[model samples]
Target: MGRNTRKRRTPLAAKVVAGAAALAVGGGGLVWANFHASAHEEGPAHHRTRSAAAQVATIDCPDVGQQLSGVPDRARGEVDGELATMDSQITEAYQRLATTRRAQAGDPRFVQNTILGPLKDRRKAIIDRIQLEIDRAGGRADDNLDQLAGCQGRPAEQPQNGDGQDGGGQDGDQNQDDNGNGAAGPVADDFIDINDVQPNSRASENGLAANGDGGSTGTFTTDCGVNENNLFNSDNLIAAPGVDNGAHHVHDYVGNQDNDAFSSDEDLANADTSCRNQGDRSTYYWPVLRLQDGTEEFDANELGGGAEGNVGRILKPAQAELKFVGNQQGDVVAMPKFLRIITGDAKSFTNGDANANSSWSCTGFEDRQVTDKYPLCPEGSQVVRTSNFQSCWDGQNIDSANHRDHMAFVQEDGGCPNGFQAIPQLQVRLVYDIPTPTVENGQVRNPYAVDSFPEQLHKPITDHNDFINVMDEDLMNEVVDCINSGEDCQ
Candidate 1:
């Protein structure tokens, strides 16, 4: 029990520490192992300049093994079902390859590619295959849960059974069922299937309006009106809810091409359209995810969860990503990137934090013209996937919501009454994601396991379960609380 409690808290605790004051240190210890360090400083030559960790602190390297202990609450039985389905898909692909080989059994042309051919070129396919195990130790529905006869089931016969809900004779893990109230009997993880809640989990740790992890069931409210359509399947909340309160953020622009959801056929079929962007170009898409979808309940995450149905549903990514839209302007082709800015006392800029480039002084906090913020911008520093920032905020209060995170010049475009800018300065950061109570190679010998249970299920990512010794509150808070606050960063 003591161990389980510690394990449960470890991931989140690490998150807190990560957000508060994580910095890249010079020497090696536990900190050096996990965090990727950078020695970059913001400068005046926008081209030769760099982006530093600023305004609010951020961590790109994540240690979520602890927090990922349980199954996602969104789709309890979907794990088993999902795994089963994935196996089938893999089988289908294999069959296709096999058929291709049979047709050209002897022809050298048939030997067009080698064994790793399909896999090597299809990074997307390969990534999709292992995405679940990599991101949060989370898996999507293999669809065998409720499959009928002749239909296959999970290959491991595992995946979603961690919670015991599938009744595969697995151990029951839920102390409380999906509703937050105690269940009449023992339960397993995956009791609920909302993406917001960890898979295989029966309890609720994050604050949500309703339990369901915002399932496809209930009547959720949005300024747009009653969302009976169950957009993201958020049981109680409406899709794009709270947009009126400024909770609305640009997730992604969907267009006919990659961003197909943005403009309709009308936008693409214009007669006198000569100049413009992708949509203006009339060949691709430019849709963006609203802030609601970007955070809280992203459609596409490492685990391959989020979003329901097979329609042309727009998915919100779990992490904020770097989008490179090929653009053709007056005479050149370019990609647009929203750069991070600085926010510290006179700018001694902190190191680009959490393996991400940082910024300071809120310099470029409000600017529409980004032509000059380019050139070396991509290589000047590093890139950070910010989808986490969406969930970090308190929503009700923009000024204070997840205020600990350094706001980007893009998010804080105008409102720079407090003084912000991009300047030349050095950015320092603590090593990212070093476990609290850092672990050593031989600390516990086989310290990776939480107990016999989890290890048997899967090999632990870190040294040991529930063994974060370096997690001191003050130190952790300092890291999280420090990013982008415009204070003394270094």
Candidate 2:
């Protein structure tokens, strides 16, 4: 059977529990819901229970990388390195916060005074170095960057019983573990039964209206085995080139085999590809999914794994579908070689949902999708993650200082913004066969979560995908021609 076409489970009478107070997060922000009846599962292995009282949730800080613009090419590498260092600093602080519950209970200001204060100082120093790098390269740096160094603690979910006490019930340094075991995240509250979600309508083609003869309605599918070659890494060359473990979590790579922190354009163009079509050497990657079931994977003791709070048995996708579709308004242009695109915000848990584009659902229930919460699929169903990349290019630069300004999502009318050209949009769909997590006593056991920055708490909202177009000029032209001619070519 195809991965997306899984057998459907027999329909059981919906189980609705009354008088349950749950933590619900929406596109705007966090919302607390006291519902008279909510949907849940009805089996011994799957029970929807209240989430544990929020632990030391996450650290919230301004995104310095998003604030930078107009950086000179000469200083980009050094500035990127400094940004990666800042990310590491936050990870270290979060690790300390996760393990210091006793100190937190003893002093209300312990996190502020001990963690945030010192973190801010370190970040300020790093920010100054970034400014110096830019200034030395004959470019002007933002003088107000130091103001973004300070961070604050965001409280986790409150207890549903109105007890106003921290959950986990630990004392004297026996704090919560970093993995999916209560402290780090993917708590019971982070999941919702997929059947409970109402079917919501979305744009027919992710905002691309493929009507009228003027639009490009074709698609090009590439068969790249889902990381079967085991190309996994913790580096993100686009965001933090030349820095090791820049992603802070392991990613599953599919296309380019030579991708790493130090890969150059020439290296990627000449590298081997997992794609069946050797002409298509583009790289497609995203954070790996893991079952927090205490099973140690190969990276269990590595920096981006157990040591960095991302412990669990990694789960490979049963299917990774990569397809490039055409523009809805006009014929799509060939993407410049080595064009880099990031689809979603990797820090949406703390950065809010402005750039969040996570779409999660079950094999049988594709009509309903969730952004912030992990879906608890019923028996016989599999989990699915979908990402649609921005398709409008600036027609000049392959990348931008902030890594996002060079591309834009299609406008509501399916037209590119001024000075931008329409390019083929990439849509990635990954399917996984994970066991449903059991929730009891306000805690999650064997919960599956996406790898994320430690401070992001492995929230589903932080799920994202990355792509670097490495197709040779001939293959790209063929893709454009196939798309414009309205033919589904593979």
Candidate 3:
């Protein structure tokens, strides 16, 4: 594959040279005096100036050359190899910083303290480690340390001219900046937007009154056992034996002791469950919601530098409904083992299309919906979010290309589509006691969001659920009987 390289723009040489000259002179004039005085007095002055310019040109900020110069000869090769990878690392860091800065544009302190501060610290630590290695090798630190340090103090430069065009030209050609680089495009307008999202129309205008007594058949419920296996905690199930936390985030698991990415029909059939019913060993789970209480438990992975380690508390759903939505005759059947079910779109939270099925509300104020914004729970109330997964499954396939093709939402009338058999629907609800934001020290702070989940995740409404049906035949029969009898059994 061909590598895509951006066109290198040489900075104005005079400006760069002048800046270096000023820095050199200010730092005790050791190298500056030698170069300046020699240039003025010697016939080869022009040549020396050219040499100095070349040297200055080589000094890229976070200068790898200077960093590697202090390493022992034997270790230099390995050090150089590692430094080569830093460019991509730095690039990735800039991308994340850009996303965070855009997302938290309203909260300057959050951008500065949470995002930029940690990034700067990490960069400095890297440089310091290199300096330490150089010192151990008995080499002096780079003479350009002052200049390099200055670079660290400044923010990463934003391209002034993109694609060699002005951003606000008469033609309204706004895609590129003056330098011909692509523009960042518009911000997302989703619930995560923090500024734009409003209450769901269906939920806000016509209160989400509970479904009353209609279509009550073929519905069964179970109180799955809840566990404390978080995404960051090591107790969570591994996707595969050798991969560590391959699932990325944490989930609360229930049923099927052998549930994992590699589990087979036999494994699921033989495994025990955490549910109240031993025969119903289906595996159901969702990401763990953390309470952001300034504690280590909710602390995001600021030091690790990734989106997976978010810090925040989980909120419970105001209402949750679980049922099988097909086979009107009330004949409930066992779901196939290894069946993968996913609910609530993770991408929708930030993509401007928050799912209507996913809902957010306060405990005592269930009639009011607050999917777009975090609600301020009352003194004794709490916040909750709900996720409802599709229940109609394609009997022939256990999985699909998108992890969703094999299963689908029920029809508007609550019936399964032809060819898609009805399976037990899983509904998940989360609860949180955290309060709303309060002005602390002149800044808007979310009391509930002490330590939060990843900033990329946007908010708690992005909640999703996954399940793998692994119930025994008798258990499946019992579930069917419970649903067919038109009784709400938990």
Give TM per candidate: 0.18, 0.85, 0.52
Q: Please report the candidate that would top lDDT against the real structure.
A: 2
Steric overlap count per candidate: 116, 0, 34
Off by over 4 Å in 2: 1-55, 159-183, 201-214
Cα distance off (Å), candidate 3, residue 250: 2.3
lDDT of 3 by residue, 1-490 (tens): 0111122221132123233323322111101100000001113333322211111100013434322333454333223333322322333333343323223333435434653455455555555655666566666655454333322212211221221112222122222211111112101111122222343443321112222234435456765545533223211122111122323345556556665533455666777776677767777766654443333333233221112323344433233333443243234456775566766543332233333255666666655554444555656776666666776778876654235566776665556678877665666666665555443322234334211122222344445566767667776777766665666666
RMSD of each: 25.8, 11.5, 19.9
Query: Alpha carbon lDDT of residue 9, candidate 2?
Result: 19
Instruction: List the candidates ranked by lDDT, beginning with the highest.
Output: 2, 3, 1
Span of ten consecutive residues with least summed lDDT in model 3: 30-39
Instruction: List runs of model 1 lying over 4 Å from the truth.
Output: 1-77, 80-95, 98-472, 488-490
Q: What is the lDDT of residue 296 in candidate 3?
A: 39
True-structure lDDT of candidate 2: 0.73
Whole-model lDDT values for every prediction: 0.19, 0.73, 0.41
